[model samples]
Target: MTVSVLLFIILAIGAAGYALGVRRARAAAGGDTRKLHSLTGYHGQSVLLFSAVPALVLLGLWLVLQPLYLDHRAGAMIAVADIPEGGSLDLVLADVRRVAEGLDLLVASGGMTEDDLAAMGAADSDLKARLGGVGVALAGEVGEGVFEAARDYRHATHGLSLAMAAATIAAALAGLVFALRRIGTDYRARNVSEGFVLLLFIASSLVAVLTTVGIVASLLIESIHFFRLYPARDFLFSLTWNPQFRGGSDLGIWPLLWGTLYVSFVALLFAVPVGLLSAIYLSEYASRRLRALAKPAIEVLAGIPTIVYGLFALVTVGPFLRDWFAQPLGLGSGSSSVMTAGLVMGIMLIPFVSSLSDDIINAVPQSLRDGSYGLGATQSETVRQVILPAALPGIVGAVLLAASRAIGETMIVVMGAGAAAKLDLNPFEAMTTITVKIVSQLTGDTEFASPETLVAFALGMALFVFTLGLNIVALYVVRKYREQYE
Candidate 1:
């Protein structure tokens, strides 16, 4: 049976366990629910949790570990001599899996019988053709050892799948029996069910923590590989940005870092003032009808995809800046430039800053504004002194969030700011950021062993560190202001 089918059966069993538990509890109480320590629904929930949770957890773990075990066993079957030159075991194993899947498909399609498959030898040159006919494309000729390994892999996988299904169902049934035996008037069903719920909540929280750790660990590991191949000092401080796949590449990060900061600075410079002003207007000055209509219309910008913003930058904003400002001012005459990306990114970030700041501004206590007004302060003065100071921390948070969005932006930078990594002061000059370079480096067929490919990880790690620093600074600012306001 398939995993999904097994899961469905287990769930069905749990549902039955729930009904049995409820009936048993009611019978023990002699149909008087007041005699029971917990509600009928609590008793039912306890049974469902017991029957399904452990079985589901086991199934998840089994699914994760089974592939590793099968891969190891199948890899062991392939002889060292069978591996092609300059190709790793991973690549060969991938081919083995494809071939195994093809064989399974062939049998399922009725093109091959179990007897025919058992009688077939690796010496058959037409094996590739037969596999191809079934829609499995191999990179090269399948070796004798690889063919044998594929067959073994397929057999092992099928056997283990059945075993997994049986074990999972058995676990569910065992839990169902245990839960049913425990059902009684004196049973603490609510407490037990609530404990399971607490565990689930804790697990849900851990997922985010675990995911963050995983990302950092992966980036750190790959970045270490890159640093070992390339000098850390050169990567950090060198005033150039170029990568040659062959060798002798100048893999400097300074240029990219400068461009990133420049573009983000311009974006924030534009977005912060406009967004903050818009927030202030909407929150403190606008009428109720205007606020309702304007807020959603402004926020609609945030819902638009970044690619669409990028196209707008490329086709409209970029050229306009190049013609009207750059050429006239003799700064630079490039359609794609730092100014182009920064402006478009600023426009894109408006909703993020405006919506968040508006919420924060509105959250300020009404009493503070009343007090300011009673003190003979005008509406504008009240906003400036009372509401603005009160909402400063949250406004800072919103701005920081917008800045982070600008820093991590890739599509706008690629489309508006052309991919020319350089240390130029002119905003009208084309430039690129770390994210764009990270994408470029990892594009196409890449070998992770090489420094060029590995550098993408290093770039990502750098970006992560920079963003972390920004978060830290924002936190410190928030805490400082929040104390005074409170």
Candidate 2:
């Protein structure tokens, strides 16, 4: 049976266990719930949790580990002589899996019987034509070693799946019996159930922490490999960015860093003032009707995808700037430039800054504003001195968050700002950021052993560090400001 079907059956069994557990608990209590240590529902829930949770955990582990085990077993069957020139073990294993899947499909489709499969030998049979007839296309005819391994893979996977099903069902049944036996009048079912739930919550929280650690560890390991193959100093300080898979490549960080900062700076220059001012007006002066209409309209900008904004930069904003501004001012006339991306990114970021700042500004105490007004300050003065001062930390935090968003932006940089890594002062010149290069370096059939491919990991680590620093600063500022007001 399929995993989904097995899961459904397990859940049904758990539901039945819950009913039985409730009946058992009432029987033990002489049908008087008042005599029990916990509520009737708790007894039922405890049984349900025991019957389902452990079995589901087993199922999840099996699903994750089964493929790795199959790959290891089947992969070992192929000899060194079976691997073609320039081919890796991973690629050969992929072929084996594909062939195994095709053979399964052939059997399911009634094109091949178990007897036919048993009688066929890889060295003397036309397996390719049979697979092709079933619409399972292979790059080439399967070799003897691969065909044998594919058969072994199919058998192993089928056996493992059956074992997993049997084990999970057995676990569910065992848990059901154990839980039912414990459903007595004096059993502390509520405490046990709540404690189990608390453990689950703790596990859920740890999942996020573990995910972050995994990301950092993977990047650090790959980056170490990259630095071993290529000089760390050249990667950190070199001005040029070029990657040649064959050999001698100048891998640099300066040009990409400069372009990233330049574009983000321009975006902030445009977004911060406009977003902050819009927030000020909406919070301090605008009527309720206007605020309601204007806030959602402004926030709609954030809902639009970044790629759409990139297209606007490419097709509309880029050309307009190149023709009317760049060419007339004697700057470069490229359609894709730093200005195009920055302007579009700024527009995209407006909602982030405006929405967050607006909320923070509105959160300022009304008492502060009233006190300022009673001290003979004008409305504008009251807002500036009382409300804004109270809200300053949050606004600053919002701007920094928006800045981080701009720095990490990729689609706008790719479409509006062309992929030319350089450190030119002219905003009209095309440039690229670290993210674009990370993608370019990792693209195509490049091997991970080379610096060109592994450099993507280094670029990723750099971006992570930069963004992490910004977040730290934002958090510190927010905390300091928040403490004073609170």
The best candidate by lDDT is: 1
Model-by-model lDDT, in order? Answer: 0.93, 0.91
Q: CA shift at 197, candidate 2, in angstroms?
A: 1.5
| Model 1, span 392-454: residue lDDT tens | 999999999999999999999999999999999999999999999999999988776899999
Summarize candidate 2's per-residue lDDT along 1-486 as a digit string, tens digits: 899999998999899988988888899999898999998889999999999999999999999999999999988898887788877788788889888998899899998898888777776566887877777676555888888999999998999999999999999998999999898988999998999999999999999999999999999999999999999999999999888899999999999999999999999999999999999999999999999999999999999998999999999999999999999999987899999999999999999899999999999878788888888999989877788878888898889889989988999999999999988999999999998888888889888688999999999999899889888988888787764544
Clashes of 1: 0
Query: What is candidate 1's CA lDDT for residue 57?
Result: 90
